[model samples]
Target: MIGRRACWGLGGLVMAMAGCGPAPAPQAADKPRAEAAAQATGAPGTAGAAGPSSTGGASSAAGGVKADEATKPAPPPESAFTPVAQIPEDLEIRLHPVEGALLVSTPNLTVVEGEQTNVATAVGVLKDGKIDFPERLRVPGWMVTVSGVHGRYPDQLDLIATGTTGRTGVAEHYALGAKGWDQRVGDAGQWFTGVARMGSSLVGLTGPTMIGRSRFVTLRGPRVGLTITPAPRKGECRGFDAEAASRYSEAEVRPEAFGATRDGTALSYGRNCNGDNAVEVWKPGEKRSTILPVPAPSEEQTTDEVRTLILPGPGDGEAWIVDRGVLRYQGGEAKKIDPPAKGARVLTASAAPDGTLWALTDDALFTRKGDAWEQAPLPDGVKARDVAVGSDGAVWVAAGGAILKHGGASEAAGAAPGTIQLQKGPPPKPRENRTLPRPGGPKCPQNLVVLYTFSKTAPDDYDFPLTRKALKGRTEFSPARFVVTRDMGQRFLAAFVPTWDLAKKLEERIKTDVRGSTPQIVCATPEVVRELKLDLKTGEVAK
Candidate 1:
């Protein structure tokens, strides 16, 4: 129609317009455009239409606009970021965290900070800002004991090593320092026994009993050693026979054993194999000694059996003694309180700050307020090996490997809770194979004696009130024919009885229903309850 150039330009304009509209059919769309827009936008060329104006301006402008829009993207969602809660550091004693500071103590040192470091042989945190140490001095190849002195600051530590090449002896005083340890005292003799401290003075036992008996020697200041001459003869102190000597030989006595200073009076308890069988009160200035005799059966008593005595305080004027089956409060006269039960034995005794006498029997904890005794509950799965009252009115007891603490302020005797359940199946054939049972619910097998305990919330509560419902659910009950020994029963009661009210209620109920027959209910003091390592949860006594 027109010149070739004009025709080509018109064709290019048509192709450019087509590109702005809807897409063409697939087969047709594949054909190259012959318009100028196709050339400018890099579109393919068609055969029928002449390729017009190879450089196309209009198509190029449209392509630029489309490319600009594709570059813009939507913004991210609003909740793309949020804050999270952070867990705080835990600060519990049982956790035993390494970063936190712990109080380290020895006999001479009360509370000392480790320079540039916080590490020691013994480490514990301050309870109510007070430190109480159980045992301290090292006895070389034997034992080490420390006093739990509350509100005292540990400053210095002195180590006295006593032992011989083959036998036992006084090695020397070695000063323990920040760098390490250095020898401060020298070796003296073999067969050394007692080591005690009075105020600033140190007293030790040395020499052999066969070689004119061991001597009581006192160390004054840094190096002065003075020997205490025993009374020319055994005074009014009863049961100082051969039995006492044998028992005394094994007991460990320390300087702090004499107790702290108060009105120029010194109180100490002597321990023997048969419990606290003797009490001694000495006045250093007056050289006067008052001895209290422990009650014991004549036949079972031994000359070598020493008594474990616990002196309450300077003003109490009485010492509590644990001699086998008897718990006697000895002062001016020895009067034995009836044992918690016929077969129960006293384990340990401690005097509370309020002058309450706490005694731990085999299965129960007995507390004496004036003359009346009350019981309290022990913790579950715990048998008390040692019992002590903390300054904060909290009672601490050691059972098995664990130390248990009760938070109540009441002095009444109580058991912890639940009955001591024997483990399932036949007893282990060997002692080494007898592993203690774990706490909580476990189906006990036959052949074991299972004991169930109930608490008394009110008077006239159920005494062996075994209803059809109470007895209906059990698949197996503990055998009643099994022989129960006094020691075994004591351990059972200590572990099961949680509170004093429960112990009293159980005692009354058992006695009423059993008609003075079998399975005696015994009372325990908190101290004794802790010593037996009774399991409070299952009420099972650990062997």
Candidate 2:
């Protein structure tokens, strides 16, 4: 049963950019000098003041608002949403219908059997007929293969993604708050094959630790750790050795080992020592396991001959498995559920709360109403990749890049001034304008500079006053510094920036402030930093 109580805790805006604070007051002795410098340099205060008299109290005396008033950046433009006719149909897509919305994901590239690596670029949600992308959530260096949203509505949810970095599988959780999403990440120390949501917690299944031994361990939490245990293999095949097979490898089936039920149970599929297939039901917070045998059409059939797909059913403890024929499992029994069509292949299936079974095939959409199955209308010459059922019983289909609603209008949501609007359109760009810088900062791959001390014998003298006086009151340059120990001995440097243009400005500023001193600006972007072996903080070559 779906829990009536809402999941996911709401909090204050987590992603809001901090507003610039008021500039410190100039010293009484230097007050007049400071005003003179501001006037002479035409340096605007927090406000846009353009004249010599704009500094000091001249602006206020002339009846203008205080200079510090405008320093706060415009509240980052609220999530700008635009209506679209269809999601872009360029890549393969998957659809997940939750309580109040439909989520669309463009899966990452697959390099191995059941193993996916690399980041998933886009994630969008369809709520009230409008789609708004929360965009991609990331961990600095982890390659995220799979990600999903766990929540009851489109507006509120937790985004979770898992992937491997080096030998460890990492999970990143992005929780939505008033402003945007906040991130929490964890490391599994082992490869994760797949992820599932159980109640409020996210669970991940780990790949085998040893070459031939099958261990069914799970990685739980952005805070939870891994628990390793051998999978139950009973019947005659209980002692089957995974390493003995030269022609067929158990690695191929590893990805299919674990699945989730609607009621938050983790389902494991395996064969006993004798080769008879069975499913072990492990619910959240439970220690005992229930094994249900899967009745194969013929005893001679091997696991490879029949493909299996486990799907969440409408009620708690219910699941639908596609093995030759569609079989529904509830309580502790498995029974066949007839296909919507005589021989049409079911690519994906979703069960609605009303017991309505929604299935997507190669060329059509079908819904099982009572005992009769009927084809759902779709656009002409359309090919859909997946299907899902919302809590309200709305059937959504992912065909091409467009979302199609059964027995509903083909256009996007209606347009209102501040409400989400929709249009029959192509996929929207990542942000409003592709060329503009993001709200908080400029994008990466920019030229940066560090105020370096070239004096090998007495570098400390140059480093102290240079950083204390020349770099003070400079809000544009970064505070972090880099240090490198080369043939020239050791040197200290400061200021890492994003753009070559910005670096040049910093260079000029430093030259004017500290007479006769040369500041060296270097290109130390993430990629360049890696190639040069420059320690990001110390600037020394990484050993």
Candidate 3:
């Protein structure tokens, strides 16, 4: 915690002893100096440090220690943040735990008027002691937050995320398919509270658009459109503010809690919006939801009702809600279970598939041991806010921007024995095509048009051969100059065809058939290519 605070302001001196005195006020004149100091620290996006005199000479050395030593930010506890993954020190990181993988979301931040605003979310996946952050997932202009991630039956994984365009929230589905990954954006008008991927169907719980009930909607894919289910008035309550409701959506029943297990998905609604609380449990493959008579938590039980977390229990029709304490719900009855943290605050908790409970508190992770709570062995000085137990019995912790794994197998996690494993391998070598010459810069036949260009990098480099084999009859391929607005100094495989219409048709086919290829249609003539300062062979930017 001291390490996290040290990076905030005042050369780490004031924040170290923040309680010792009144905070130093920022002055107009010191802004430039502070900015320079921030840049000097290699963390230009961090908040500026206070002026020297603002510390009242308090930053000076004490007990023969140097002033510089007192102000240096303390080394962060051993985790992935530092020398491990090389993530920037200043980005805000949030963790969402999946079955075998951990999703790390770091929002791109830029300082505007000394305040930071999120421009985009950088997505990274941690598995098998390594992090794989594909370049394409780092989308700009759209701010996306992942709400849930689920591993499908075979090699596929699906991400349930909400992308906001500053004006409206859009539900996004990222499905790992034969083409590596593809996204389907559903303009559901608002973000989903959470989603459950049951077998072949995806159902999401969101706020009620009208007063008196929360609504359930279907998400993404061709067969499933945005279909809203009307809510029952059983546990209707007035929870949302009248003014705020009109500001976002006219939904009446806001989702208060949601959770899912192998057996089913459960959700509870009735937040201050003029209704009593109701819990709905829907089993997989079932068209109807079973309404449970669950009451809302008393004010004394929870500080913020919106922050209440619901966890699916091991047994069918059972679920757990984490409010002030853990509450076990089954058979229309609620039972209070003693948390492993005792009276300490539980930051997050997870239930393993075998009914074991794991809870993370401020100090350490607690697991039930007989009748007593046992603390799991963690790296010394480590602090984490979230915990999840993998199916293989490995403990995963999300601290800051990095992921920490414990007790898992050394090999990368794999799909079940009967299921298809994730695709892995080196890039395939380009096929032998002797008759046609390799792509020459801007030397295309007058009738030839650029269909698509693929980067000569791993994963994508593998696509060249696959695309060649798949579309051998329709187009010709060559090493073409790949240009951005300017030369990117990278090698690329440019696909060419005789007509623009054929190129367009080929572009769509490649995106669908080729694995991991997202190509754009570009009709680059020699003059247009030269104007863009294009070159691909040497990977050196054209002067």
Error of 1 at 445 (Å): 40
Point out where model 3 deviates above 4 Å: 1-88, 96-101, 109-119, 127-130, 139-141, 152-155, 176-182, 197-202, 208-253, 269-276, 283-286, 295-307, 368-373, 400-402, 409-543
Q: Judged by lDDT relative to the true structure, which candidate is superior, 1 or 2?
A: 2
Question: All candidates' lDDT scores?
Answer: 0.30, 0.42, 0.41
For every model in order, what is the number of clashing pairs?
98, 15, 23
- Across 29-68, the per-residue lDDT of candidate 2 in tens digits comes to 1112334334334564322223333454875786654566
Model 3 lDDT tens row, 1-543: 000100111111001100010000000011234444453343555433322233325434333324454355433222221212222334444444555556665545442434655455556665444455565445333545454555632255665555543323344567666644477545433334455544456665543111222355555432323322343344222122334432122233344445565565445433322333445555555555555555534323222101245665667656666543556776656666665654565545666666566766545567752345677644434455446666665666544333445555444453233232111122122111011011111222322223233334445323334644455544232223322221122223444445544544555666567654544432232222222222333322347
Residue 84, model 3, lDDT? 24
Candidate achieving higher TM-score, 2 or 3: 3
TM-scores vs. true structure, each candidate: 0.37, 0.45, 0.48
What TM-score quantifies how close candidate 3 is to the native fold? 0.48
1-543: candidate 1 lDDT, tens digit per residue: 000000000111111000000000000012233443333334545223223333345436655324333233322111111111110111101101111222322212233455553222232433332333333422222211111212222334443333222221233444434444344544432222323445466544332211123344454344323333342233211112233342122222111123322232344333322223343456545454565544542223211111133334324444344433334343455466666556555434555555465666655566674656666544332333345564444555433222334543533222232221212222112111001110111111111211332222423222223321232332222212212112211222222343333433433334344332212222111112223322323434335
Q: Which candidate comes out best when scored by TM-score?
A: 3
Cα RMSDs of all predictions? 35.4, 27.6, 23.3
